[model samples]
Target: MLQNTVSTRRNIGGTEFPILAAALPVVANDPVGDTYWHIRLKAATTHLSSRPGQFFQLRCPRSEAGDPFLRRPMSVYAVDTNVGEIAFLYKVTGIGTTGLSTLVPGDTLDVLGPLGVGFDINPEWDHVLVVARGVGLATMGPLARALHHNGVALTAICSYRTPEATIGLEPFELHGSVHTVYDTDGTSDIASVDSLIREEHARRSFSFAYTCGSKRIVSLLQDLSSQLGFGGEVALEQRMACGLGMCHSCVIDLRRGDTVESVRVCTRGPVFSLGDIVAPEETLSWYRSCDESAI
Candidate 1:
């Protein structure tokens, strides 16, 4: 399949391109809330080796609003290879996303994608657990489906600030077990996530845990996995300008050994082994505090 594939011509920053072409229905409005939009991009390339927790970079429809020239990064929600389409779940938090929200069907939006390392799925892992919050739900959707198709057991706990913040979970239910945890207040706390994992662990020996959205939550899962003796993986989120690895905007401090090391979230991972990452406690606590401060 790689033989027929063409290297992504749109070089946003030396990244892999899952974005084949901009789909005609350029913008799709999902009332996930006044804040979020679900978009579909036409991917002409045949091989989308994208796993869960990988992300894409998107350029909003061009306009006179004088928005940032840089593309904004987003997570890959799902990929339909037979149809040659890749989907995105994004929230309109700033000028870039606001411009994206105004686009209608047939409008053109430049996108580059399927970039970054993704979650690892092992055939030996009979049971899989997914933990995510808000828009983070988009990052893990495809993995759940892939695992289901492979006959691996799946369970998910997706959290949102309120009922309106939830979408795209129905697809998860169709494939495997799904449980929603709607936070009335937008806390995105580790306590709730910890509770969910504990509840699930009591029932069965989950082989692996997949997480996305908040770094704090990822760190928490990593800690919980260690305590429970289950392996874990995390999809990280960081503010990015170039979706590719060229820019160092998304560098993260990782533990390589006794020393803390830097890893780029764009290329090295949107996904990382929970065990391999270093400084989980301090780094994630800072990140979660910032997230709460933003709200």
Candidate 2:
């Protein structure tokens, strides 16, 4: 049976707690290419109970004169209960992320979180596949850790624009098998990723598949899951001005039976079952036009 690590009635997605956190030392901050950063922050006791796949809205300290007015939504990379700390892995995408990279130890940040519904891992599944690209790997770390602790076998594939862009592979390797893929340099490609998923599915017959990345990749995995006769879940990446449900900006169209309805990604999920979602063609086009290096 799946251990109930979180309470269903706790309103994990609805409740938002504002917290003032102090920056801890960086775990790994590589400023080459796309600039991968892994930052840690001291958290309150309540925040320490964060589950995998949940995220936080972080307001970076103001710059000298002008700064971003809105907080950035970041995935909960990992939570260290022992130290009362939470971590986030992010790429320097815009002003918000660039500001986050500049923080030194003891810097304070306004954070609101442990929000959104997280991945629901079935305990019955003996083995599962986790597919992620770019910074999406950050969201999967905590889920992988939970699965490892539960003795569930994991096969993870992390893809990046280049080898230098990859971050936080050690934790996944420690928990289960890992496969890395990159673009342009020919280290790996979409075909290789598909091949790995096929091979793993054929060999172990994955109990489920979990993925977070570009809409293109998520769509591919969703199709693969259907073809392989296994259920899958996807964590979406969307622009959010508000981490709460009040902002309809993050709404996604979901398919329910024969009809489609809109749902808030922030409140309902950053994570959703593949079967429950309907990705618009425009989203796929946007993903194709985007620079692979851009997070």
Error in Å for residue 153 of model 1: 1.0
Clashing residue pairs found in predicted model 1? none
TM-score of 1: 0.84
Please provide, for model 2 over 107-199, each residue's C-alpha lDDT reduced to its tens digit, 9 standing for 90 to 100: 665677667788888778899998887788889999999999888899998887777677878779999999888886654566677787898
| Count of backbone collisions within predicted model 1 | 0
Top candidate by TM-score: 2
List lDDT for all candidates, in order: 0.70, 0.75
Off by over 4 Å in 2: 1-34, 185-188, 282-295
Model 1 lDDT at residue 114: 59
